[model samples]
Target: MSGPSLYNHFRTKDEILEAVADSVSALVDLSMFEDARDWRTALHEWAVSYRAALRDHPNIVPVLARGPGRRPAALRLADAVYGAMVEAGWPPAQATSVGALMRYFIMGSALGSFAGGFVDDASAYDPADYPHLGQAHLLAEQQEKIDERAFEAGLTALLDGLALQYEQARATT
Candidate 1:
């Protein structure tokens, strides 16, 4: 659509961005949480689904990170995720923060190319100057595996921390 045509439907560029963000959120399968046994399970499933959606539309990751601006789909997705966290025994404030944290993680993962941007040539990392980067040359050959493992590790760490919080919250109450 032309700029003028888009403007007719969206009052400003921010509005268009909000629409795009909503569209991207729509791609996520929130229903995956419908039968979740616990909040952690529900959130893990949701996060995976969300990450997949963002991966499919890496271009919208920045826009999504900006926050949902009066967009129904985005709002609904956020609400569902937060609700699941609360239901799973998290305090409201903690749940909200966890939701934000997960969003930031997913956005960062989508926006950055962990492996693709690496300089894989062995000569790029001289042993004397960059002894720690000895594995740099292997990055290009193992980019996909590296990226996937990094994402999984980060996700697991985040969830594990959140689980601890949940347990602590339960103990306090």
Candidate 2:
């Protein structure tokens, strides 16, 4: 039923999928430390670009959520990230894991930020019912927080940990 509805509206999933893939691919090429030769710079560039893309096209999250194996663009993006890590001298297995981790973190955080209904201040009520959430909501209002800086910081920390692992592995082998 869903397939026919989707098909009637469009040719195939790939039809819509390709547009997203193309946009993301072009954006990745434009950003992601294209001018820099170092992997650390490339990694930072990739993170910034990924965050910007997610912010620009919050609707694309569902499509990308299908996983790299099922989505050509996602597969290509994953391949590029891992390939860059490998080119930086990390082993293939480590590169693959770290790439996957970075993608998952960025994608998940984007979804959380834009998905709606998750953290709306208007929905916050019954302080005694959900004490912790209510307190956080109050704190958010008090702090006037406008963006997910923590998410970006956590992603950086995760990449830092992966870089450490890469260094250790390189030392051993």
List the candidates' TM-scores in order. 0.88, 0.71
Candidate 1 lDDT trough over 10 residues, lowest sum: 32-41
Please give the TM-score that candidate 1 achieves against the real structure: 0.88
Compared with the true structure, what per-residue lDDT tens digits does model 1 show for residues 33-136? 57756777777788788888898888888888888778899999888888877877788998899889998988888887777886768888899999898887
- The alpha-carbon lDDT assigned to residue 170 of candidate 2 equals 83
Which residue pairs overlap in candidate 2's backbone?
Answer: none
Give candidate 2's error at residue 65 in angstroms. 2.5
lDDT digits (tens) for residues 59-105 of candidate 2: 87776666654555566677778778888888888788877777778
Q: Candidates' lDDT values, in order?
A: 0.84, 0.68
For model 2, the stretches where C-alpha displacement exceeds 4 angstroms are 1-10, 29-37, 68-76, 114-123, 131-147
